[model samples]
Target: MNLLFVADPLSSFSVKKDSTLAMMLEAQAKGYAIWHCHIEDIKSVAGAIYAKSQKIKIDMAGSPWYVSTQTKEMKVAAFDAVIMRKDPPFDMSYVTATWFLSQAKLEGAKIFNDPVALRNHSEKLSLLEFLQYAPPTLISYDLKDIQDFHREHQDIIIKPLDGMGGMGIFRVKSDALNLASIVETLGDSGKRALMAQKFLPEISEGDKRVLVIGGKAVPHGLARIPQGGEVRGNLAAGGKGVACPISEKEAKVAEHIGPLLASRGLHLIGLDFIGGYLTEINVTSPTCFVEITQQTGYDVAKQWLTSLEQYLK
Candidate 1:
């Protein structure tokens, strides 16, 4: 099957840790026609969405890496499926790209983790819909709301509503100096929303990252425990990854959201939980397959592409 992946610059991928890169490499190994493009390369001309892209081949186990390039104008429909693998700052351009992809979908390209559903859900806000399974979360820009949360939860964590990879996330466990000022300075009021939740003590065990592919749980994943003095449990944020098993609580989280999201076009997703409470439902830029592969010696890219092939069938 032919697949197009929209991502960052071609040379920026670290297939060692990036699941998207690993997936592309795996697909190329299987003789699937793999193509790559960036969001900036996507454009609309006369009501058609096109990209300046190149077909690439990768060897996940090799150093020189695999190679193939066909720099040409490509349409989304030319591929069997479009994998939107770009990373996030989730700015205006990202939303606009999703809008363009939805148009491409209407014209007959199959998009995984649905473009329209992604633009609507935006990861963080979507989890609020299943609040019962999640910790006490507050979406507010109001300083008073944050202050009140600090007063009640006493130990509260504040994160940007659009945050990913644990960026711009902070813990306010004490009445530290300028706590109120920091809250206002970090998370804007009225204009944007910040997620304030009761800080969980179990975070030291590392947060659990569960990858859902084709509406089912992938076998291996990691428990990313935060280092001492760190509240954010992201690998990039100094969190250590330990090969850990998923608990019944993590499975329940997947069971509840998997079918619903898959039906909505979110065929692949990464759901984050810490100490068994739901945190984020990562629809856009869901990662962890690389770590999972390293831990269990299975190629998740093969699993994902196989699912795409079945869907195309």
Candidate 2:
């Protein structure tokens, strides 16, 4: 089966520590012919979507490094599954890819985390319904509103609603001023909505990345702990990962949202929370499945593939 992964250029296939790389690795190990394409390589011609992709392979013990190229455009229907593995900023290019990948879906290709679902939920913006499970959050651009949230919560986290990998996330204490400048620095007035949430103190214990694949919560999970004096616990942001235990509370949260996410055709996603409060619902290229697998030696790749297979059949 041909599986095409749409991802960032910096991502490609060799970046092993990242979750997307791990999923690709498992697919390769299971002998599924894995192919890759960069966002820039994707194009639409004559109303049919195409990509300048090549049959790429990963060599763990590398030297000359990657061994494929020439970038020829191919029909979108040729693949069995297209994993939308691109990491977020959720910018125009990413949105454009999803718009075009919708064609691949029309051609009967199984695109995980369905294009519509990704379009519906930008990384930090989609799961607002379960606010009860989340810290007090406000999606706004007004500096006054942000200031008021800080006043009420005393401590708060300001995140760009479209960001991922914990980028552009800031924690503000009541003593911290200059929020007006910070909000302005984020964007033009009213041009964007910043995601502001009450800071959860339980972050010292760590934030949990609960992997929901194919609508089932896996036993494997990771606790992303912030280093001393940090509020962000993203691995790319220097957070450490420890295997974590999922409790009834966490599982119940998962169960509540699992069917909703699954119903949207988002087969693989990682929901994050701090102190038992939902911070984000990662539908667009939800990662971290590999981190948990490596920590617990659980192979979830088959679960995802098998689920897609069943649906497609």
In lDDT terms, which candidate is top? Answer: 1
State how far residue 240 of model 1 sits from its true place (Å).
1.0
Candidate 1: where is the Cα deviation over 4 Å? Answer: 60-66
TM-score of each: 0.95, 0.92
Model 2 CA lDDT for position 199: 82
lDDT of each: 0.82, 0.77
Give me candidate 2's TM-score against the actual structure: 0.92
In Å, residue 289's CA in model 2 sits off its true spot by: 2.9
CA RMSD, predictions in order: 1.7, 2.1
lDDT of 1 by residue, 175-215 (tens): 65566766777765356778888899999888888888888
Q: To one decimal, what is the Cα RMSD in angstroms of model 2 from the true structure? A: 2.1
